[model samples]
Target: MAATEQPISYAQDIKPLFREGDRESMSAAFDLWSYDDVVQNSDAILGKLRDGTMPCDGAWPEEQVDLFQRWVDAGMPA
Candidate 1:
């Protein structure tokens, strides 16, 4: 977790986990477009978090993980 990182904005919650260049994780990867287009498809990003496929290499903490799931379940707020 970075010093100023937010809890679970897609940018804050998910991007830091994987190789952004790849959008893949220890569990699985999204489509090619997902990796390339995170800004427009935050739900896809949240899908990864909701299913607990993120925080790879243990980069994210439980609270952030909770936030990720909540954000997704809440319809991925803008």
Candidate 2:
């Protein structure tokens, strides 16, 4: 984290990245909106995101993926 960089949190940052349909589609696997689930599965999720295999509709923008990676690297905060 840089001096001016704000910390990332699940509620304020990561959770909103998953859409309602995303949560519905991934319900069988895990709840995308759940902090614990996400934290547990963050690595696999990041791999899928990086490879454009998540969301199942289309890949997220590079910036969004980068944001996710940043959150993960930042200790999967909150």
lDDT of 2 at 33: 94
Whole-model Cα lDDT of every candidate shown, in order:
0.51, 0.91
Instruction: Give TM-scores for every candidate, taking all chains together and pairing residue i with residue i.
Output: 0.37, 0.93
What are the clash counts of all predictions, listed in order? 0, 0
What pairs collide in candidate 2?
A: none
Candidate 1, superposed: residue stretches over 4 Å from native = 1-28, 31-56
Top of the candidates by TM-score: 2
Candidate 2: 10-residue stretch with minimal lDDT:
1-10
- Compared with the true structure, model 1 gives a TM-score of 0.37
lDDT of 1 by residue, 19-42 (tens): 544544332534433434554555
